[model samples]
Target: MSQETAEPGIEASAKTAEIEALKDTFRNVPGLAGAPMIMAPALAETFATHQHELGVRVHPDLAVKKFIAPFRGPRDAFNPSGDYGAIDTPATPIPVLPNMREYTPHELEVIVGQLRDMGVVNDPEPPRDVAHVVTD
Candidate 1:
């Protein structure tokens, strides 16, 4: 039996449409102007990039407590391995690694271009210098 898969281009387009619709919905909400829309993949990458720093800030004695026994629960209640099992996780349409090094200029341009096309951003060119602040 042959397995059927979604065409990459079509899948991407559908995701883009979904994102645009969500943006439009958010745009109409009061008091939400200028808020940034962060997708899951971007959030995951951002978490990974600054994980060490985050751990230090959140738990100063994390290194010292690293050897502590982890909490155990029923296998059905807690999955230590983080396995999704049969759950189907959709792929991110736009893969973005948010960091000083991993996020490349090309990726920035592509994202900016997409935003411009969606009328979310008006600038013809992406900003040369962007500041990212991480706080505890």
Candidate 2:
């Protein structure tokens, strides 16, 4: 039997509205200013652009950690390199690789533990059984 579904345009518009509402809600919060997930389009961009303007306090959530980890530093710290107007040559993009790094399993565990301490990655999902065989 055929089932009725929302029109693609309507669905898209609804999703857009929902996203806007979420953004508005985020903005209303006391903190989370310049948060990448709340404002930036992609995870990569978020990692690159989000500044930790909330001082030393963090929201203790995965979204905050994922976005803020790369830009963790004093908000008032001035970057001489960031001043592009004084430069005569074209601005060279800072390599994104600086923010992206591979972590070993032990390193990952340490990171997870740190996040846990900060209440960021609390209540992680239980590990699944990978040894089970699939049967038809």
The most accurate candidate by TM-score is 2
Q: Model 2 clash pairs?
A: none
Candidate 2 per-residue lDDT over residues 1-136, each given as its tens digit = 9999999999888655544433332221223453222222343233322332222122324232111111333222122112212223444443444222577779879888899999999976899978978899
What are the lDDT figures for the candidates, one per model? Answer: 0.43, 0.41
Name the lDDT value of residue 127 in candidate 2.
92
lDDT (Cα, tens digit) per residue for candidate 1, span 1-136: 9999899999788655544433322211223454333335444334444543343123323322111111243222122322221223442243344674566899888888898999999965766897889999
In angstroms, give how far residue 100 of model 1 lies from its true place: 50
Stretches > 4 Å off in candidate 1: 1-3, 32-136
Clashes of 1: 0
Pairs with backbone N, CA or C atoms under 3 Å apart (clashes), candidate 1: none
Best by lDDT: 1
